[model samples]
Target chain A: MSSKTANPVMRSAAWRISLWATLAFACGTMVVFAFLHRFVASDIRQRTDAWLTGEVEVLGDVAEHTPKDALYDRVVSEVAELASNEVPNRLRSEGHSNDLVFFLQTDAQGALTLWVGAGRGEAYLDAIRRRPFKPDEPQDLPVAGSDAPYRVVALHIDDGSIIYLGLSEHDELRVLRNLRFRFFTWWLLLVMLGFVIVFYTTRRMLSHVREITEAASRIGHTELDKRVPVSARNDEVAHLARTLNHMLDRIENSVRQLHTMTDALAHDLRSPLTAIRGKLEMSLSAAAHGEQAEPIVAAIDELDRLTEFLNTSLDVAEGKADALRLSKSELDLEELLRGMADLYEPSMHEKNLRVRLTARGPVRMLADAALMHRMISNLFDNELKHLPAGCTVEFVLETAQEQAKLTVQDDGPGFSQEILPHLFERRVKGKQSSGHGLGLAFVDAVVRAHGGSVAASNRKDGGARLELVMPRGLAAENAEPRPVIIAIAGSGKP
Target chain B: MRLLLVEDELEIQTLLRNSLQEAGYEVDVAGDARHAEQLAMESAHDILIVDLGLPDRDGISLILSLREMGVSAPVLILSARRSVDDRVKGLEQGGDDYLTKPFAMAELLARLRNLLKRNTPATGEPTRLHVQDLELDLLRREATRSGQTLQLTPQEFVLLEYLCRNAGRVVTRSMILDKVWGMRIQPDTNVVDVHIYRLRGKVDGKGQPPLIRTLRGVGYVLKDR
Candidate 1:
């Protein structure tokens, strides 16, 4: 799991998608909470104002209708009850909260007469005293000892006294703070839920895509029968699986058809060739010392040459078509070259040719052993067939950087000027050659298939030179060097 | 020696029948797998030459049937399928040897003769082999001509052994390549000729009559006059 998250792209993609989605959802939730906050705050303010206005209206009506003695008696009792921390008799009848409200009234003499409130109310009364009260509009005034601001409503009563109704904003603010707290808690939960949802959906979708990629990587030439499993979901991923399977089917069919056709063609062409060669041999043996014997023998040789040409031609064609089935394995270059040399030693002797093999230790490479043998054999055959008597063929195997280089050089007339550049081309042969001119072409194909290159050129010292370089197939670079051993005197003797 | 030649092509059947019979073998020809199977069961032949592409059934299956029927004649597969896979499958399915089509007559004859030599029961057999003045010890891997030990390389020993086995018969270069180097066919090279030349030097010493003769364009033949 730690290794998986170490990839920056995978980590960032998941984080980015989840984070952006959570942020958008959180912003939308905040907008909704803000709207509810505004509505509740306004409703609380309106109820507080209505309660204060009702109290003031009752006091003004009592002042107008009742005798001075009765109204004064009621006002004195209300102030006494408010001062004693009890609800006022007149305000209590309407279920008003006078806990944080201040009621200040004056008599007709324009003197401060009634300032009745206590505790938090006393702070509100002092705030009213510091500022001149307006009768038409409500004013907000800060309490002297509290962070709450008061909503003060002042009125001119018929008793020639002004009345002020101040309601503290502390309760409303506390209610709003509590509502905001609850909203934030819910928003946090919402953001977390949004993140998990986005992460899960994205991961599940990408896992299906990963399955397709893995299946594709496993498909090769020999494993054409394997197909990506199609899902039951009628979505885009399943559709892609179906399309890939269809394409594989087409490829496998074409390959099978090609193989069958080539096999049939080869069998058909060789049957008559075999019969003809057989007839020629019988005729040559039965000729009984006549002119017919010479031509019959010649025809038999020609047939043998034709059969060889056909086999090499088919190999070249198959190599070009990418249809050659090679079983690749690790091979020792020195050992393989030695085997070829031993096999050809006798032939080289008959041509008066000297064969030399030079190698720097056992150079290893990955290749198809059979094809590589044929390639080397063809190279030797080319030299022996073309070079005159008394020539030397040198095979050198060594390493150049990470590549294993094999150079086949001969001390004979170099490739003719016209054919030097086209030495490896198909059907390019010397004038006196009996080959179908596909030898070097086969060598080139085999080398290229092994991720190597083959080149032919005329040596400046008057000979044809061919070089084949292939990548060394071992991880020798990372191997630790052998430690040097120092012989201690008499260590074993002691 | 009695040989069974199973081939579908009429011309190939006629040619092989004539050549094999002329080489002093009693040859029987079969045009298809059914006929070949019938012949294999009835005749106690020394060798069976079967072609891969037969009309009724493939040659590999026919060989398997023959083996199942307890007919122990050495079977040689002749096929135009030159792929290594076909060759391996042929050998694996009870075939003693495999020769692709359009082959040299000398190679076929040499291989057939060699197979017969292998199957022949020995009576009072010795580890040493002799051909006129030449002698070879099978165990020590040494050769001597007229009591003079001949220094020979491992390859020369194998080559000479093959030539000595098919003493008076023509063994083609392809046959030598197949037997000595274990190669199927190598064209346009004098590797076999050169080896034969070197081996002749040591085998035919001073004042010794020439024993190995070149058939020229055909192959080599060893005999004692």
Candidate 2:
């Protein structure tokens, strides 16, 4: 549910990979387009300049060979018109009479001798005169009346005059603009296509991995036999699924082995213990009123203690190994605590101790009822055994931050300083304590198995305090519900 | 009452049979599931005590088959597996009661008696229960002894009612916890002893013969002498 509600798109590896790849591709294509645009603009300018230089040279030669008369002017003008018409007309707009090129002749006195072009040649001649021009070289010059600069080439003739040929850069600029527009449109389309392709392919490839993760999450401890679905494609995801399944197989095997081992051990050990206790009881009943009866009863009590020790040891071992099996059910902690308090009230009274229970309403959680009962009983037993007379024991139960908190405090001699650090460890207890030292260890195991935490400390005011915090509604998520079957014959009250 | 016991261990089988016979019941013994089934089908019995570790087949499957064969007698399961899950499994498979192995003979007998009592239906509903001079008005939830009103809390009343129901029979602490307080696991404390002590003080006044008797290390019995 959390995975569904979180920002899944940004978190997904597929989306991140595709977005980065698209960015890289877009940048690469833009750089290439910029280089190509620069090359094309430069190439067009060079061709225009070459054409202007050749025309200017030929016109200068024609002026030098002709006599200084009206026929000479007519000959030069005709040659210039023919040359201007020879320029490329591929991108030229129709119904435009000007050839987009101009021809001019200037005498030594800096006066315009002849002009042949679309616009008035005075602007071009003035623009050329403003900056000293090198003969036989084409340079860009901006005239006063034109929006586009002209590429002009000048040549010196034998009659102390200069011939100028200027070609308008309007067509070159238009060609470059068209190239850029088309390139940008295509570039945008390609970039979008690249993004979609990368995103789609990456998502398709990673869907199997997501499926495996979902399936694996569904397999709880009880359902270890279930395995994730492996894709048929022999890819990395499939390999990962196979590895996980193999690990599960080993785990299930070891768990099965542990169960078998504990079961066999319990059977082998408890059978003999049962027989001995039975014999002792038979003898005790027969010698109902003699000293023999007392000894037999004591032996039976010792046997019972031995049995209790065995059960607790096995339980602690399993719990420490993280293999404790839990049968979960919904229970009210407040009710359970109250019941425990009532059960212990009489015993506490006999010891001249006072007890109080503080709780607010009900705090419900899912947990193993039997384990919870034993865990709480162990706590009470400890207090009953250790606390001095006239001491008070307090139990407080409440829910905080979606966790059930239970605190048990007593006004008695706290734990010995030496054993305080290792209190929860197995076989750790005070020097004067007469227990097998597994009571607190068992409690710690139960709490840890339930995914909770427990702490034991001495209050500064001379008492012991134990606190436990367990997450609510966690066991239900991990344990599958078992069908309940009530025996029909014993359903009624006796 | 006639009873059937199926156990694989020879020593336990002998000990239990001797104990049950001494308690004045005719018990039939079997060493395995096959023999137990044969004994059960041959004659009707009032109760069956089954050990879960059977040589031939699991005790759970045996119980299921017996139930299917129309053996409606209540079953008491004896087992070495002490986990709650195992206990629940045994009961779910049609066992009426469960006792873990290495148990006290008194506990086993108490369970047997309790199971037998469950199988027999009471004649009818009675609004009041009378034992000696003590009177319980079930309808009003009140108690009186020797014509004098007794003060009892609601929980104490329930506990007295349970004791009165099985007046002559011994009721163990675990039984009282289960029946009166609805607790399954027995806490290691003398809560039962203290409660019984208080109840005895109230039920038998200074001159009255003590009605509640304590069997040290076993349980309690209420007898009208």
Best model per DockQ: 2
* Model 1 stretches astray by more than 4 angstroms: A1-219, A223-245, A287-294, A327-334, A346-370, A385-424, A429-434, A448-494, B41-46, B67-72, B84-95, B113-127, B138-141
Pairs of residues at least 3 apart in sequence or in different chains that clash in candidate 2: none
lDDT of 1 by residue, A1-494 (tens): 23564466446566678778888888888888889888988887777666666666665565555565746756644743443243222233334355456666665554556665546344555566788876746767887776778777777876577766666676667777878888888788878888889977766666676688788756655467799878789999899989999998997787667667767777888899988888777666667746767777678777777777777777676666555555677887767777678877667666677787877666777777778877888988988789898888888887766788899998899889888787777999888887778999888877776667888888987998999998775654432333222111111111
Docking quality of model 1: it rates as medium
- lDDT (0 to 1) per candidate: 0.75, 0.81
Worst ten in a row by lDDT for model 1 chain A:
A485-494
Per-residue lDDT of model 1, residues B164-210, tens digit only: 87788888888787777765546566677877888888888778889
In Å, residue A249's CA in model 2 sits off its true spot by 0.7
**Separate DockQ for every predicted complex:** 0.50, 0.59
Q: Which residue window of length 10 is worst by lDDT in model 2 chain A? A: A485-494
Give per-residue lDDT, candidate 2, residue A207: 84
Candidate 2 chain B: worst-modelled 10 consecutive residues by lDDT: B86-95
**Residue-level lDDT for A401 in candidate 2:** 57
Interface C-alpha RMSD per candidate, 1 decimal: 2.2, 1.9
